[model samples]
Structures are given as structure tokens and as C-alpha cells.
Target: MKKQRPPGLIAIVAYKAFVASLLTVTSIALLFALKNHKILENFSESYLLETKLKIIELLLDKFLIVKPKTLLFSGLAAGFYAGLTAVEALGLWYQKGWATILVLVLVGISIPPEIYELFQGLTLLKLAVFIANLAVLWYLLHHLPKHGKAD
Candidate 1:
């Protein structure tokens, strides 16, 4: 990684890592979705399906369809968002002034939805995400250059 200035270096790196992680996870999910399709299709018509379904039902009550097309679409959608995140992360990491504002604006936009989700259910994950976004928003506002200060 290239050298980064202090102040928000850690935050910027964390953001970059977060985006990179999403890229890796989504990429792997895409592969898993596509590769497991055949095995799932074969097992669906075999005795293995009965045993697997029993075990799965016991573990989780959720229903899942392992169709390649659906998986492909999901992966593509995730990858698309991940790509955008990557670009923003790169910009932020480099400390481009514009990137900070861009990220600030984006995070500010996301806060409303996060607040809504928190309202829907006060889960730990939702709270953490909201707080994290709030922190990012605060950090950006506090650190980013204001008005004509940008040069």
C-alpha cells in the first residue's frame, strides 16, 4: 500500500479494506452459486436431497433456491456495487479532497436508511452500522476542508 497521511489514514484504509472485502466475498459467492448449481440440481432428485433437506431444515427455517441464474444475477449486482465502492475507496485512500466530500455525501445519504432500519428493529448489526456511518459522517465533516478552504 502507498503511504498515506495522518488524521484519517486509518479510517481511509479501513474503508478500502471494507470495499476490498466486499469484492472478495461477492466474487466467492458468485463462484459458489454457479458451481453448486449442478450438484444441487442432481441432489434435488436423489435420496441425498431428503437427508440434506432434513438437516438444513433443522439448522435454518429459511428457504433458499440455488438456481445458477439467480446466483449469477445476485453476484453481478453485488459486484457492481462493490466496484463503485472500490473506486470511492481508492479516491478516499489517496486523500483526494473531492473524495472526502463524495464519501461524506454518500454516508450522509445512507444514514437515513440506516435510521429507518434501526427503527424497524434495534438489532446489534443495525446499530453498529448506523453508528459506524455516523462516525464516518462526523469524521468527514470535522476533517474535510470547508468552503473556500479547499485548494
Candidate 2:
């Protein structure tokens, strides 16, 4: 059996999961708020409401207009992230190998979009997040103990 490493990697995974969970909760809250608005009570009553109603009228219309598929995919991805994070945090909290590798993979996949956004119009918040993400990625990849597993 391989000796386990310290808890640093899982700690980072937990932090990332915490952020994703916050986003999930925020999105659900926004959906609920939109659904409960009185302006949406009778979706066919006014022109604006009718437009909204038409947008939601059919599966294809809703799929294309509201991009529910994208939302669904995002929700699923968030859930997956949370699940992976929890597994790493709780099960192998002190096991550096798997958790560290997973974090690196996640960061690798996420950085491209941040870079693309940076080229369009740089905002402080976006730049801050991108930098923070890069920092976290660097910290995890660099601090993880060298073992056969990492190769």
C-alpha cells in the first residue's frame, strides 16, 4: 500500500466545491424568483407576456430560445464537480494522488474559457477569478508530493 500524503489537495477541492455549490444555489434561486413573478402569472395576457409565453410554448422553442439544454448541462456539470470534490474531500482527504490529479484536470479544462473572456474585455472580477484559478491550479500541482501515481 502506498503511504498517503497530507490533506492539502482535498482542501483545495473542498474550496472549489464550495464555490460551485454557491453558484448552483444562486441559479436555482434565480429560477424560482423568475417563476414566481406576477408578470409571468398569465403568460398570454400581454404582448410581453405573450412573447414570454411563446418562448416557453414548445420544447423546441424553449430549447432554442432559453437554451435549456445548456442550462441543464451546466447544472449537471456543477453536480459532477460537487460530487468529485466531495469524494476527494471526504474519502481521500489526505490522499494526495487522485485528488491532486483531478484538480489539475479540472483547472486545465476551465482556463481556456477564462483566457478567451480576457481577450474580449478585461473586467476586474473576471481577471481576479482567472488569476485566482491559475494560482490554485499552480499551488495544487506544485505542492503535491511526488509519487509514481503523478507520473
Best by TM-score: 1
| lDDT (tens digit, per residue) of candidate 2 on 2-72 | 67654654456566667767766755744553444443434434556445655455533343344445555
Candidate 1 matches the true fold with a TM-score of 0.72
Q: Residue 13 of candidate 2: its Cα lDDT? A: 53
Candidate 2 Cα outliers beyond 4 Å, as residue runs: 1-14, 26-65, 88-92, 146-151
Q: Which candidate has the highest lDDT of all? A: 1
Clashing pairs in 2: none
| The 10-residue segment with the lowest total lDDT in model 2 | 59-68
The local lDDT score (0 to 100) that residue 144 gets in candidate 1 is 72
